[model samples]
Target: MASCKFLFIYPDINEFSHAYDGNNGCYYYGIAQLSSVLKRVGVETGLLHYTLRPAKEKFLNDIDNFTPDIIGFSSTTMMIADVYEWVRWIRESGRHSPLVLGGSHATLDYKRVAADGLFDVIFIGESEESIVEYCQHYRERPTNILGTVVKGDNDYIFNPARVLEQNLDRYPFPDWTLFDYESLYDMKTHKRGILMAARGCPYRCSFCSNDRYADLYRNKGKILRIKTVDYVIREAKAMKIQYPAINYFQFVEDTVGFDRIWLKEFSERWPREVGMDFYANLNVNVCNDDTIKLLALAGCRRLQIGVETGNESRRKEILKKPVLNKTIEAVVKECHKHDIDVNSLNMIGLPFESEENILETIHFNARLKPKLLQCTIFYPFPHTSLYDYCVEHKLISESNLSRTDYFRESILENPKISQEALYFFRDNFKTLIKIYRYVNIDWLIRLVGYKRAGKIIRLFRTRSELKKWLYQPRKKLLKYV
Candidate 1:
C-alpha cells in the first residue's frame, strides 16, 4: 500500500496583528506535534502556513505539490469563520482530500462543527494517538475510531474521548523544523525562540476555556503533565543548535513555574545546558521570594503574571480566582527584587463589573508598578462559565459572540458602564497609570475619575513632546563627546 500523506493548514485570520508579521510566533504546536508523530511512522507530512501567503494561491500550490490524502486544520474560536471559508473554497475548487478539524475550537464545539459539513472528521481533546491510529487504518472504516466525530450520511457519529498521554516524553519532540524558523521572532521582545514544556492548566478560571477543555478528558489520565526535565533540556539544546540566532526563549505554558520539583530540576540544568535568557508565565499564588530567587538563577529575565482584576470581591466571586490584591503586589515586588522584569495581564469590561471596579484595577496596577501592563477587553468565549453567565444575563447576544477577538472591543453591555466607556478605559489605562504614579493622590484620582484625570495629564503633553525632540540630539552629542 502507498504511504499516506498529510497536510496541516494553520488559518491566518488572526485577531492580533503580530501573527501576520512572518515571525514563527503563530506556529501551531498541535500540528507540529502531529507531524512528529506521523514522521515516526514514515508517513509523508507537509505543513502549510496559509496565512503567510495568499490563502487561495497557497492552498492550491500546496495541494498540487504535496498531493496529500488528508488535510487537517487546527483552529481557534477567532479563526473558525476564516477556516470555514477556506474549507468551502477547497471543496469548490474540486479537491477531494478528506478534511479533518482539531484544536480547542473544534473540540469545544464538536457538534456544530461536525454538522456544518466542512469537516469529515473532528478529533476531540488530544489527537496524537488518534491521528496515528486513523492514518494506519485510512483504507478501512474510521467511524468506529475512538476520539473522533465522523460525519455520516444522516448524522455525525461521536466517539469516545482519547486518553491523554500521561508520559509526555514518549512522544517525539515537536517538529520545529516544519516551520520557517527564520520567520518566527517575538515582536514584543524581538526574541526568536518559542517552546511548550508542558500541557494543561490546573486552575479553572471562569473566563478561560481550559477548565472546559480539562473536563473533556476527565478520565483520560492526568491532564496536567510536563515533559521530563532531561527531555526539556535536550529540546532546548537542540533548538539552540538549529537556530543559532535565537538569543532568548519563551516558554508558552499556562504556568511554567507551577511545579516546584520540576522547576528546581529545570532551573539547575537549564543554565548549564541552554544558557539563554528566557521568559515564562507564572501564577501569582505559587510565587514567593524563594521561587523568585530560583527563577532568576535559572536565567529568567522576565515573568508574565495574571493580575486579572483588582476588585477582590469581583475577582473571587465572578472570576473564581481567589487571589488577593496584596498577594499580587508582593509577588511583583519580590520579582523586581530579584532583578526580574514583570508583565501583568489585566482585563477590563468583565460581566457584572462597574466603572468603579475598572478604576480599582487601574489603581491596583499603578500601585504595583509592573514594568509592563497588558490590559485586554473581556471576551466571553463559548463553553466558559463567563460565557454562560453573559448568556443568562443577556449582556452578550448571539450576534455579539461572533466577534471572539478580545482586543477588538467589548461585546458585553453593562448598565453601569457603556461599551464606549469600556473602550476609553482600556485604551487609556497605561496613560492613567503613569498619571496616577506622578500625582500619588488617591482622593484626587477618585474625585476626578478617569476622564477628567486624562484631561489633567494632557496638560503635561508639552514636556513629552520636548523630550522626544531632544532625544536624538542628546544621543548624537553623547556619541561625539
Candidate 2:
C-alpha cells in the first residue's frame, strides 16, 4: 500500500489575530513534535494551521490540495467548538478522510468527544508513538491499538493505555520546518523561535492539567522527563542554523527550574554553544538565588513566575500551592537583582475566593512590582481538582465548556462575588495596581475593599478610555506618516 498521508489541523478559535503581516503568532509545539515523529517513521504528513488562515475558503482549498487519508486535530478545551464545526463541514463536503482528535481536552474528555460521533479515533495522553502505530496498520476495521479510543460498528473500543516515553532524548527534534516560521513570531517577545526542553510537570496545582495527565500515566514510568543537556544544545544549534533570523528562544516547558542539575548543565553549555537570549517559565518554589543566578548566566533575559493568588489560606488550601508570599517576593527580587525581567502570572475568580481575596492578590502583586503583571480569569479545566471543586459546588454556569475564555471572562458563578465584579477587576487589574503603587492609602483602600475601590476606580475610567481614543488616531496617523 502507498504511504498513508496525514493532515494535522490546529484550530484557531482563539480571538488572538494570526495575520500574515508583521504580527505573526506562535506555533503549536505538540503538533510540531507529532509531525516530526510521523516523518521519522517514513509517513507522509502535512500541517494546516487554521489560525494562519481561518477562512473556510482557504481551509477547503488546502484540504483539497492535500487529499490526506487521515485528518487529525490537536485541540485544547477552548478550541473544541471550532473542531466540531470543521468536522461537520468536512463530512458535509463529502470528504471520506477519518477524523482523529488528540491533545489535553480530548484526552481528558474522551467519552464526551467520542459521544459527539465526529471523531473516528480519539487519542488519549501522548500520541508520538501511537500515531505511527495507527498509520502503519491503517484499515477500514478498527484495529486494537493502545492509547486510542476507536469507534466500532456499535460502540467505541477503548484500548489499553499506552506507556509514557521514559527516554525523551530518543525522540527526534520537533519538525520546525513543518511550521511556516516566516509567518511565526513569539507573541510575548516577538521572537521567531520556540522550543520545549522538557515534558510534563512534577507538581500538581489544583487548577493545572498536570494532575490528570499524571493519573493517565499512573502505572507508566516517571511523568517528568527532560532532554539531555547536549541534546538540547544540539537542537538549539540546529534551530538557529535553520532559522537564522530568530532573535531569541523561549522554552515552553511547565517549569524549567525543576531540575537543578539539568539546569546547571544547560546553563554552562547553552551560552557557550547556542549563545542566544532565552526565556522560560519557573515555579516560585524551585526558584532560589543559585538557580536564578545560573539562569541569568545562561542568558535568560526574562523569567515568568506563577503567583496564582496571594490569599495565603486560599492559595495553600484551595489552590494546593504551598508557596508563601515571602518566597514569591524573594524570587522576584532575585530576578530583578540579576537584571532579569520578571513577569508575574496571576488568576482571579477562583473557587471559595471572595472579592477581598482578589484584592489581596492585587495588593500582593502591586507590592512586588513585576515588569509585567499577566492576569487571567480562572478557568476550571475538565479533570482538574479545581474543576471537580466547581462541579461539587455547582459553580459551573453552563454545560458547554468551550463558552469560557480565560482572557475574556469567568464562567463560574461565585456566590461571594458577582460576575460583573470579576470582569471589572480582570479588565482593570493593571490600572488598579498602578494606582495602588502611586497612592499611599493602602490602609484606606483595604478598609474600603475591592467593591468600594472599584467604584472609586471607575471615576478615572473615562480618562483611560480617552487615552485609548487619543492613541488610536496617533497610531493610525503614524502608519500613514
Candidate 3:
C-alpha cells in the first residue's frame, strides 16, 4: 500500500468557550502513543487538537487540507457532544474517509458508540497491536481484530477484547512532536514537563473507569504495570535535555508510588541524575511515612492526594475509597513534616450529599491544612458504578444528561442537595476555608441553618453584580470574627 495520511482529532475539551488553538497545555498519552506506533509502521500522521467548537468553514478546511484516509477521534464521555458535532461536519462536507472513534468514552461505552452509526469502526481497550493491524489493512474491510467494534452485515461486530500490554516500555515514548510541545511547555506558568511513568491503578474508585478497565482485561495480566526505574529515569533525562527550560516534572500517572520497590529505586536515582523538582499524584492509601520521606529525598516538592470526601462512612461505602480519616490526617501530617506541599483534591455535590456534607469536606480540608485545595462537582461518566447508581436511583437519566465539565456543575437531579448550595460551596470553597481558619463557620451555619444559608448564597448567582458587592463585606466581617 502507498503511504497513507492518518489525521487524528483530539477533542481536548476544557472550557467550551475557549478557542480551537493547539496550545492547550495538555498531552494525551493515547493519541501521542498511537501516533508514534503508526509512524513506526511508516504511516504519515497529523493531529487536530480542538478545544473549542469549530465553525463549519474552518472545520471543513482542516479536513480538506489533511485529506486523510482515516479520521480518528479521541473522546471522553464529557466530550462526546463535541465529537458528534465534528463528525456531522465531516459527513456534511462529503468527506468519505472512514471515521474511527477511540479513547475512554469509546472503551467504556463501545456498545453505545457502535450503535450511534457515527463511526465506521470503534476501538475499545488498549489498541496498540490491533491498531497497527487495522492501519496496515485499512483499504480492505477488516474484522475479527481484537479490541474493536466494527460494522458488519446485518449488525455490528463485537470483536474479542485485546490483552492489556504487560511491558509498557516496549511501546515507543509518546510522539510529543505531533503536538505543539514547546508551546504547551511555554504556556505553563512554571514550565512543567508532564510525563507518565506507569499504566493502570489497582483501586476501584466508584467514579473512576479504572475498575471497569481492570474488569475488561480481567485475566489478561497484572492490572497495574510500572515502567522499569531505568526506563523512567531515561525518559526524564530525555525530556529535560530536549526541553532545557523545564522547571519541574509532573508525573501525570494515576499514582507513581504504586510500586514501593520501583519508587525506592526511583527515589534514589532521580535526585542524583535528573535533579529537578517534581510533583506526583499518590493514592492517599500509599502516602505512608516512608513513601513521604522517599519522595522528599527525590526532590518532590509537592504531591496531590485525593480525599474525595471527608465523611469516612460515605467514602468507604459510597465512593469505595476505604481510606480512614485517621490515615488521611496522618498522610497530610507526614507530608508537612517532610516539607512537601500537600494538595488535597475533594469533590462536592455527590448524590445524597447535603450542604452540611460539603461543609464537612471543606472543614476537613481546613484541618488537613493542605497547601492547595481543589474541589469539583461530581460528574457521573457512563458505566462507572456511581453513574449506574445515579441512573438507577433516578438522580440522572443515563441517556439524557447533557455534557458537563465536572468543575462547572453536576448533572444529577439530587433531591437532598440543591445545585445552588453546590455552586455556593464550589465558588466560595477557598473563602470558606479562609473563614474557617479565623472563626467557626459552623456558628453561622447553626444560626441560619443549611437551607437558609444556601438561600442567602443563591444571591451570588441570581444577582451577579450584587455578588461582588456582598462578598467583600461578608469576608471582612468574617475577618473581624
Error of 1 at 128 (Å): 0.6
Residue pairs with backbone atoms closer than 3 Å in model 2 (clashes): none
Per-model TM-score, in order, reads: 0.89, 0.89, 0.91
Q: Local distance difference test, per candidate?
A: 0.79, 0.81, 0.81
Best by TM-score: 3
Name the lDDT of candidate 3: 0.81
Cα RMSD of all models vs. native, in order, equals 6.0, 6.0, 4.4
Q: What lDDT is reached at residue 344 by model 1?
A: 89
Query: Residues 1-481, candidate 1, lDDT per residue (tens digit)?
Result: 3379988888655566543554444666678888999999978888776554356776677677988999888888777887787788889999988899988888877877876778888988888889998888876757878899988778889998977878889988888878776675452336457778999988888988886887787888888899988998888888778777778888888887778888898889999988889999998887755788889999999999989898988889899888988888888898889889999899998987887898789888889888999988888877788888888998887666553677768888888787666876776677767655444434434645545544544544443642343345544423322
Task: Flag the better candidate by lDDT, 1 or 3.
Answer: 3
Show model 1 residue runs off by greater than 4 Å: 18-25, 52-58, 187-189, 438-481
Count of clashing pairs, candidate 2: 0
Query: Which parts of model 3 have CA positions greater than 4 angstroms off?
Result: 15-25, 185-187, 442-481
Q: Kindly report which residue pairs in candidate 3 clash with one another.
A: none
